[model samples]
Target: MESIVSELEGTLVKDSDPFSYYMLVAFEASGIIRFALLLMLWPVTRLLDACGMGDCGLKLTIFVATAGLRVSEIESVARAVLPKFYMDDIDMEAWRVFSSCDKRVVVTKTPRVMVERFVKEHLRADEVIGSELVHDRQLVRPLPVIFHDGRLVKRPTPSTAILILLWIPFGITLAIIRIAIGVMLPMWAVPKLSRLFGGKVIVKGKPPPPTSGSGVLFVCTHRTLMDPVVLSSVLQRKIPAIKSELSNGDLVVCPEGTTCREPFLLRFSALFAELTDRIVPVAMNYRVGFFHATTARGWKGLDPIFFFMNPRPVYEVTFLNQLPHEATCSSGKSPHDVANYVQRILAATLGFECTNFTRKDKYRVLAGNDGIVSYTSSVGRIKKLVTGFKKVVSTFKPFIQ
Candidate 1:
């Protein structure tokens, strides 16, 4: 197979006449016949349903004739009509213009011998889709498979038959499982979890006067996927923009009131800063990275649509005051270390009393230093420790010394 591929690669011509280009397009198109037939079957079925029995039969006959005509007659017509497609001999001026353009170009030819050679030698395109040709001596014979990376990659396979044998039943099973999960899970679970983690509130830099709309930005840390969810639940409003793919259901579990548009997410942070004081920018401080992981610049080029979106203001939150090395503290200690550490920082910086205590009645271990626990465990321990410290401090009266 490798030797056959190498022989084929060696025969690839640097230039081709018009006849070769048409053959390539036809060869590539033949590989998709089965998939195309399957897709056509649905519309054909619908047509059959709408028509009388005689009409339905006629429609099926027409479909067969149309497909047959394409296979038998289209090639000669296409070859005669298509201009002599040549890429290797493209003038230097044309090459300069083509190279400067940001958009991708599709080069089509019947057999595409010249296009394939040009692609192999010069174009490092994201993708290439073209037909194949078999050559014996000087004669070109169109092949069933398209050549990619010097390999006959695409072949005429019974795609519909394979889909029926494998994919259809699997797809149905998947749909059933998806429906079960979607129906069983509570929609409120996200909000409830967010509220449990100190329901999102506008972290004010300074107390503001009584105003109907305050431009509030919530700057938080980003560590886990749950961070954004928790913050959104606390805020009770959607983050203005999200990744465009997420908007299109690429990312499941869209936040309530949160609509993600790639363009909007890319720029809204800065635009919001300019438009209204009510704009709230929420960011997370990860202990590892010195800055918030999500930033205006980071969002650029991530989505095609983001380039056109309005810019919004972004505020950074350095919640974890200490660096990661400082936060690691003594290992082999109880999880209580986490509680104590958090409490100390809050008390020192925010002037809030934070403590660690065991929730004996709940039969839960509250705090210890082992970091290798679930997020739930860490949150439970932190809450217990902070609550306990606050209680202890409330009861103490500083004696005049």
Candidate 2:
């Protein structure tokens, strides 16, 4: 067999610098606290790399990123988040040569988990020789990454890291001010007052005409937690927050169930379609200079705070035409069909692609488990600890004897 051997970092992938990659792992898998710790030690890692101890620096960086993290969490990030970034950095010429081989093997100093999935699945390599064991982008993933977790939407290079650290104080203050303005002022005055505080809400396409009887479901693209609030301000009326009791008055809902930063829309829940025939598809998008308001692994409560921390946070609300009576579930259409139709309409208006991916897919990829959190009993935990201890003691019996 004609076998091709290649290095992953610089041969197939153009940029060998792993700082940004490690930063991504640290932030996504662990949290901002871990990311901050890694950043604080970055200078030392860089110095080691510059002084002929590049491998040592790489080890140090990996240690910081993966230390104390569960294997599953790190693997989840490796499988989901890193591939997107890695594929973007692939060298076209190198890939051409690599793909032409009958038998392909790739080598990388990076941990096997990080590249294995990308290499074997995306690159179709026969074997991967890394520090541990196995391999693995395309803009189109071998596996789609519908869900990912992290607040830093932008890649964190050294400069970006420094800027984020510096901006935290100002960001916190600005977040508080933005929150205060929204809470204290009337909906009609929010857009006006927000401008003075560096907040921008651009409204396009007037709201759909009101309908009589039963509440109208405002189906919106999930951009951030602030979607309903922004829409409410634009409509100059209170739009009830999500996951609330449905009332006779109109309501807002993001069928996606999670915030998606990309221009693609996740599958809408059919439950919204069954809720009412009066549906107004809203295309919502946002722009932030420094931070994103969405996260998968991090605390979601802080999303609003991070969103307001940007220098000027912008939200564009485009209200599309209301769904016709014949196009809804009331007209004998399946709930799924109506939901998909509305999804396509909103995607077209925003110039985004419609995806069948949903919230469960998002959590499963970004996090190791399904989105549900199961609490273990304290007694069950102690039993597990005792069982583990017995196994360890049994293994040491020979040595002790």
Candidate 3:
């Protein structure tokens, strides 16, 4: 048995091109005929509709038969029929014909040799779908058909037919409705909706008085595309940072902009600072990794808008920080360890316990009780404690009646 297998492994075989078989199959299949009919019907139907013949369109009722062509022959024909399409200097029609075959053809010159080589090299079909041949040390002899199924057998049903039969008219109706609404409704409806739902203002602390003439480094968590918008609303001022590329045409703010490139961003930042007296830095904490800064995909192309808008008068340096969650888990430290470290750092640097670090419902909330603080929680209880202390101080103010 081992000797036979070894002898068979080294044998060579030849195969018919799979492309020819597929082209033949595609030519015969009713699905292909239906698609062709639809393609032909579209323009004709449009012309008829323009002439008040709204219901007249071609229906696929007959199958067109054609002579079976060889894969090589089809390649030449396709090159002549469609010269625009090319693949690897070979006519794509060849590939299409082969890919459409029902089964890949394989021919073995000797029974002792495996037929796999021929199937792989010449046919390039996912599977061999034909008979093997045996040679008695001299001439080729046909064996029983192997009938291997190719990958093409698992074709998904084409949706185009269904769309033409049922969904096309419905889609046209929906498009008409959309156009009507667009023309009839006020354009402000969209911006108003955006303001109501998309606009978010998160008050980290008391808003600075207008007369104070002081600036702050606004820091918050950055998660969604709407964070900056929300932050700007909360501040009630144009964020000094920058607008993202997608927000370019839509933004009302003049000074801020976003950029992906580093060199251009640095130069813009420097120039903006030179023109603005109050450089309000903005930062966000992303919930992944220990990196202090992240390149936001949406923020690219903001620098050009900022440069053109030109909303500055004096020079000042304002640093923006983007802190991702991964920064907490630095050097393989566990979440608990990182959380504790963050707590300590906040307490030391800010001179107060961190408060309102956890999210509640749709909004972030301060912890109400010690029991609410858990080791598994993403936010620390320190922030909550600080917020609570501030409320108590406000209640006992000396000038209060």
Candidate 4:
């Protein structure tokens, strides 16, 4: 069998900038605290790299990013998030040659776990030789990463890193102020008050008047966590619009179940279609300069914080005609048919492409797990951490003795 030996990073990827991937692992696996620690140590890493000790710098970064994270958590990021970024950075010329070979081996100085999955899965390498994450050993995609979680949209190069380092303090203050305004003021008063802080909500197309008897189901295109909030601000009505529940007042549901940043609609779940025949399709979109309002891999609690932190965030809400009695599930249309019909209507209104991809597909590609949020009690997590720490301490005791 013809075998080929190759290197990763510069050899396979067009750009060798590893900071962004490291930033991702730091932010997704751990949290902002870890991410800040890594960013603070960037100067040290750069200094070490400049002194011709790049491997030392790499090791330092790996420890900062991966420390305290579970093996599974790190693996989740590698499997879901990193692959997309790596695939985007692949050097076409290098890939052409690498793929032509029958057997493939990849080598790199990066921690083996980081590159091994990307190498074997996407690059189809037979073996990866690289630096082991813990010991010393050996190491490693072109897939459009459609979904990813993080506040930062741009890759964290040295310059970007510096900007983020400077922005955090200001961002937090801005987020708090923005959140306070939303909380303190009424929905009708919010849009007006928001402008003082660089928030803008543009309303278009007259919203259908609220139906009198049965509750109306507002089917909205999911753009950000703020979709419903923004929609509510424009609505000006105080009628209760809860998620999933069909109230006598009104109900709001995003059938996509997850946010899609791009101008494409994930498959609409059919449950909303069967909820009620009184359906109103809502098209929503938003723009932000420095931060996004949605994530697939990171702590979702921060979605609104990052959203409100944007210096000038703009949201546009368009309301379309209500679904007629003939077009709803109540009129003998299958639930799936009604769902697809609403999806197409919203996609058309927003100029987005309708896709059959659902929430599971999004999370599977971006987070390496199902999109469901699992709750592990804080006590449970503390116990797990203590157990793992004891194992590590015991393992090193032999060397110390």
Candidate 5:
């Protein structure tokens, strides 16, 4: 708050009777307040600060470059610093006025990733311009790996473990109920569940039916942990893999291994070629959320579902032409070539840059992990007494939050 007050005070260079001048003032004031609140609440900022990044820190440098360190420099800095989580925790209350505003809405934000296609999400918005700050052109910040959402069986604290155990029957029961309804009446139930959970799915072009009996592989770009649910509801089918041979119906598959914020697409896995000829490449974008889940398929446990169910997520999907499935293309292309060709198609369709780096690379860099399970690691469990039956507390700090 002191920072906000000082920033505004420092920037007052001139006073004019023009209406535009006051409006400019208002915009600067609004942007600073919003960004100040955003910075204070962001866990990542706190984490970075804890790592000895005080005023002369990496984040402060980026923030100053994007926004301004001094009041006189604020407007010149130009872009607003939006935390990565804006999509997941959207405040509709804050956006309501903008949704209905008649004036030209220009969203200038930082970290180039945040503003990608954000203009398309709001129909009434006029323009948006974004910027990015990179350490040698790559915005890779080192992060620590946590066991929170990666594996099928997460090692939880005693309290959360008990809560999960208690919720098992409920989760199973809910899963069964939803599955029965979805499988029996996907055409009807999926849309209903989607709306019930505050999700919107937009599709482009005519695509094969989800119920098309036979082998069909649905491929698309990734965005957010909520994707599996949105994709499941949008396609009206679960894309789960099975060794039981899915020679029968349509099965959807996400091409990019995990949700990504980078403009580039991760390496392609030729899984579609291994399946039947009905390989459909799709382009996907999301209106909200940035926390990309790093765990592999079938590894994430139920608690991960908690984020998807948090309310307000939107998915936009565009299906492209089916890839050539011939053993040899007309140009004598192998299956590997065919896979790359499909990746190109998907990239061109969605405006994503194609890259060879795996999602694990992002996980390792972003999570500050060695990317290998620590074997032969042991811990001594120490507990503190609790008043009443409240539960025990551990004195040891977690590796990562």
Candidate 6:
């Protein structure tokens, strides 16, 4: 496999066309990775150029005869240069005005994208000298599994897959047992599960006295979908409108009022007002991996379940002191007010930036499916109505649990 990659590398550098200047650059990939790739390609490109293989180095390969290179053009170039491996992330349409043809293409890193401006202002550089930024990022994808396996042949790859196949059954059994325990006996399971995630699930501070003489209701601030589960609470129908009622002596463990991933807390549910005077604010944060589910940026694929599947996964949970009983909607404070107070405390505890946006706003941005119309048919009208309804519902709050 190294030989294949090595040969491919040789071909890319060794066979350059004489008429067109050829040089490789990356704008996005980290410096180390792109530099390594450039080192491999650059030297070979230069050596081939030295051998009169291409009129590359003779001309300012830094400058371009053309700009606005599109994906089709990139495909053509890669085919003529390195046919075996296809690079991704190029601008798809006839877009990506990398630089004007008259300007010199400056092969530089993104962190230094302002280099030209700096030089022109500070060093009195010539205004006529133009630079085109050559942005060829690191390999778009992971090195082919074959490159690592060194078999130069194909079959199963991904070292983790083999490990998973071997221990997956045990993992499944353990997961089922753990999840069941967490559901049935929360006090016993919360700590163990918390430890598995990363931090110990220990009582961080004093908890308030039970609202009812019979028991205490814990309200934790959630950071991920698993917050309820890890805290030994149910998942389905966890939250509805704030007005929903719960049977007396029913232990309601809700965090963040709603299930969302932003770092802020939502207003407290008033339904708990009558049920419990003792409201404990639990704060926990679930970290994201390579991909993220950050609403502030954009929706990413679910990451928590896969996170648990890792061999040595880590998670953490922390508990804040119980909110003052008066602050717990006990002193004529509205549920929303109590929730805001707890959110502020939890935000301080977790060092998270609280925002005003709610989960519905997040959902609308992720998918509305109403904008692209296929002529205004009854179906289209229905879709638009549904979209409008969702937007409306997102703005209002109801009293339910």
Best by TM-score: 2
**Candidate 3, residues 113-162: lDDT per residue as tens digits?**
12333334333433432234322221122221111111111112233333
Please, what are the lDDT tens digits per residue for candidate 5 over residues 126-189? Answer: 3433353221121212221111222212212223334444554555455454434444553546
lDDT of each: 0.29, 0.76, 0.28, 0.74, 0.43, 0.37
What lDDT is obtained when candidate 6 is compared to the true structure?
Answer: 0.37
| TM-score to native of every candidate shown | 0.22, 0.81, 0.20, 0.76, 0.45, 0.41
Candidate 6 residue-wise lDDT, 90-185, digit = tens: 122211221112222222211122233322222222221223523332221222110010000111122322333455466445445444444454
Once model 5 is optimally superposed onto the true structure by TM-score, how far is the C-alpha of residue 379 displaced, in angstroms? 19
Please give, for residues 1-401, the per-residue lDDT of candidate 4 as tens digits: 67798888788987665777888788767877887888888899889989999888888898898988898888777765676667768898998998888767787766677777677767777777876422222222333445655566666666776777688788889888877777666666777888988999888888877665567888989998677667666776543445434554666788898789877899999988777888889999999877878765434555777888887889999988889999997789999999989999899988988887876676556544433442223234435644554453332221111
Candidate 3 runs further than 4 Å off: 1-160, 179-184, 187-401
RMSD of each: 24.7, 11.1, 24.8, 10.2, 16.5, 15.7
**lDDT tens readout by residue for model 1, 1-401:** 01112111212223322323323233323333533453445455456656755446334533432344454233322221111223223454444444454432334332343343333334322223445442222112221111111001112123423433353354344434432332343434533432332222234333222223323333222222234433433343333223332232211121111221111111111221222222122333222111111211112212111111111112223233322333332334333343344334433443323222222211121122234463356456546654553443232112100
What TM-score, to 2 decimals, does candidate 2 have? 0.81
Residue 158 local lDDT, model 6: 26
CA error at residue 359 for candidate 4, angstroms = 3.8
For this target, which candidate reaches the highest lDDT against the unseen true structure? 2
Q: Estimate, for each residue in 247-329, the C-alpha lDDT of model 2 and write its tens digit.
A: 54678889998778777899888888877777889999999988878665444456677889999999999988889999988
Question: Candidate 5: where are CA atoms >4 Å away?
Answer: 1-187, 210-213, 224-228, 237-239, 289-299, 302-304, 325-332, 369-401
Better of 2 and 5 by TM-score: 2
Cα lDDT of model 2 overall? 0.76
Better of 2 and 4 by lDDT: 2
